[model samples]
Target: MSFYLSLDDVPDLARGAAILGTGGGGDPLIGRLLVEECLKNGKKIEILDPTEIDDDDFVIATAMMGAPTVVVEKVPAGSEAVRSLRALEKHLGKTADATIPMECGGLNSMIPLVVAAEAGIPVVDGDGMGRAFPELQMETFGVYGVSGSPLAVSDENGHTCIVDTGQDNQRMETFARAVTIKMGGAAYIAEYPMSGADVKRTAIRNTVTLALNIGRTLRKAKDKHLDPLAELSAFLKDTIYGHGTVLMRGKIVDVERFVRDGFTQGFATVESFDGGHEMRIQFRNENVIAHKNGAVVAIVPDLITIVDVDLGTPITSEALRFGQRVAVYGISTPAIMRTPEALQVFGPQAFGLHEPWVALEELSAAR
Candidate 1:
């Protein structure tokens, strides 16, 4: 828990984090970059185990909400992350003994580190979601009946709203998204008030260590020109959840993004260079479903990633475009995401697809 991770170690951690995210947390790049910048400025990220805290110590999960697309255009002023957590502490009437990274993907993962450093608290080494997802309530926190209400969200312009929604994490999510859009499409949020024992019961533990291990492995693979994918598969062993072929390779032809019901909804078309197939990828901040050559190929609860094979970098759902020869990879999902409630909120049907929700791995293996 005392280890200080360097900027170079972020990718593997993020990759592993994404797997844990289980197709819900947002992208990890923004989070990695933010953490890296903090380290560059001589900031140190402290990791803590839930057991290290006192039973009654205050703990909170933190993340960002709004359009991931808008975040690139309007970079946070660096202080916005910490501001939301600090504000929440004032509202809760106690100093947070530790800051918990709400989820382990994209910007949310780094939000708490900055808050922790500024507050001089240790950042809990675990997170609510192992991977990324769009909805606030779709986490182990949900599994344990942790309502994501009573949240504090803030924008760069210094607009802060302390919400007390009781049990309506979804409605709270909707409300926060609206405010975030009006404020320019992205804002930081502090949510899920919990204690140490509750933290262990509801959180995914030691993910930071797993992330560090994965990051280190990927770096070694890169240096050795080893097949990063294969190395990862071997390293993960039983944990590789899902795997699938490219289905089809192509450049992105078009993208349609719009904010509705407090979520960014859209899709992209990848015209296969092989000239015989095509891929249609759909998402809501997080990649949820993908189709190939007019055939439904992949669906949520699983992970679909479009990596520039040559660059070994992931393409954000927004940056996906036409004319780039890309390789798409699919990962198996954890069984929990298949829960009816989880799927109703993020499945293929949730994205407006008529196909009955089918797990991607099943379809991929069948192919």
Candidate 2:
């Protein structure tokens, strides 16, 4: 069923999207505020189920590219989203009939709502990645052979670039990252234009709804004084994510962060409150690896998230602070992400880790 996303839904949507971000995807605060501002200005955003879209309809996926910290400093002009879409449509010689989020995490998930509201198009409820990844080419759409070419990038300064990188998705990311760096570290992009039929086949189905449900579940759990972690695990187990395992409960003891090539690169260490064990996590915008007591417990392509043990709020890679109590959770990647081709693109090897890929289920069993 189709529904209008009102101001009231933004909080849950943003919270859920952040959780899906797996500690990357940028912080949801700026994106959530952007959507709220749009709503306050009387903009209406409608979300349509993928099944409602016609097979031939044109759908463009949109998102912000670059460091989340930079985005917070340089606020969007509010028109960047629609402007990028229009630029892409001009390049394609067809107006987008609808829009979809390239990823369903932190800022990108809500950025599409801003696009749909401004462009007067409905957003498909599905997204490219059920959760968020750090890179543009990490999505199911790219894995399923959708070209990332003819992309349009727009900055807050009204500068726009329409790029055609042919069939090389990696090249497209390279070009876009350079452009984003040149644009003062952040820019909105409209790329991966696909038919509704292709979107249905490649996109992770109903992730928007799933994110909303997750957010609502967390909020409800808090209200009822229930264990939020337990609630989240139950919710994930019933969905495509399969089981959610609590990897550890600890306090952040150390952090090392720096920006390289327009991306946030960092690692954090968490020590158990009792000081019996420690966990180390490496990240490039997202949590890419986790080590429990000196053993690799989880790695890329599997979802690694950290939440505040008290508030149940997700802790983004950029927001992890020393001395904060957190619970680390690991969830299984979608079935599509486990395929050999997808693994080649997102597995541990893709992240320069020499270790073989380990499924979250197996990791849980070993635990």
Candidate 3:
């Protein structure tokens, strides 16, 4: 099914994307404001289900790449996203039929929307990564054997460049990261051009709708004076994600974060209210792993999210601060994301963590 997004839908979508981002993907506020700017200018944004696209339709993923912390300071120049998309189309000698999000995140989720609205195309209601990751090749399109070449990147100063790194997706990410740093730590990107048939096979289906439902669930729960975490967990259990739980509730005790290599790398420590238990989360743009008293509790491909304990509003990694009362929620990734092939691309080892990848459900059961 397809759906249309009015101005009224932006907030819920941004909120949901933020949670799914699992503490990365740039700022939701920046993305929301940009989308609103496009809407206010009379552009209509349409969202088509992945199934709606014809087999040969040209689709591309659009996103902002760089450290989430840097994105807040270096705002997009509004035209960069659409400019990159057009540049990619020019290179391919074909116009884009639709745009899709590179990942499910605050900034990334809305980048495709902005591009679609400006380019007069609809957005596919799905994404390359079901959740956000720090690097370009971590997306399923790359993991599932899609080339991320002829990638277009645009900076705020009206400069656009194309990088065609053949099938070496890691090389593409390396070169792209260097360009992003030179562009003042942030740039808009359009990559992983695919036919609709490829999208149906590689894209994580219905993540846009998933984000909307999560935002709606949190809002309704809050409105009805229900426990937002409880309601959210129950709702997630019935979704493709299959499992959701409050991993820990505590105050952030310490944070060590820095912007380096065009990425935000850091860890945060949260201590229980009674001070007996502690959880530490590590990140490289998005949360990668969480250790509860030195035991692996949640790891990547799965989602470890931080939210305001009372309001259920997601707190991105850049926003994690000392003394904030927060709840760390763990949710299982879809089966496709947990496959052996997918893990080799984005597992704990990929992030330099030594622990073997473990499912959130199994970890919870062990606990």
lDDT of 3 at 80: 95
**Cα error, candidate 1, residue 134 (Å):** 1.9
**Where in model 1 is the C-alpha error above 4 Å?**
11-30, 50-55, 240-248, 259-262, 344-354
| lDDT by residue (tens digit), candidate 2, 166-195 | 888888989999999999888999999999
Give per-residue CA lDDT, model 1, range 180-237, as digits (tens). Answer: 7777778888888888877877776766676666556656787898866566556655
Candidate 3, residues 1-367, lDDT tens digits: the string is 9988989889989999999999999999899999999999999999999999999999999999999999888888678989999999999999999999999888999998999888999999999889899999998999998999889999999999899999999999999999989898999999999999999999999999999889899999999999998998899988889999889999999999999899999999999888999999998999999999999999998999999999999999999999999999998999889999999999999999999988999999999
The TM-score values for the models, in the order shown, are 0.87, 0.98, 0.99
Better of 1 and 2 by lDDT: 2
lDDT preference between candidates 2 and 3, better one = 3
Minimum summed lDDT over a 10-residue window in model 3 is located at 70-79
Highest lDDT scorer: 3
Error of 1 at 52 (Å): 4.7
What are the clashing pairs of model 3? none
For each candidate in the order shown, give its overall lDDT on alpha carbons: 0.69, 0.89, 0.93
lDDT score at residue 210, model 1, on the 0-100 scale: 62
lDDT of model 2 at position 344: 82
**How many residue pairs clash in each candidate at the backbone level?**
20, 0, 0
lDDT of 1: 0.69
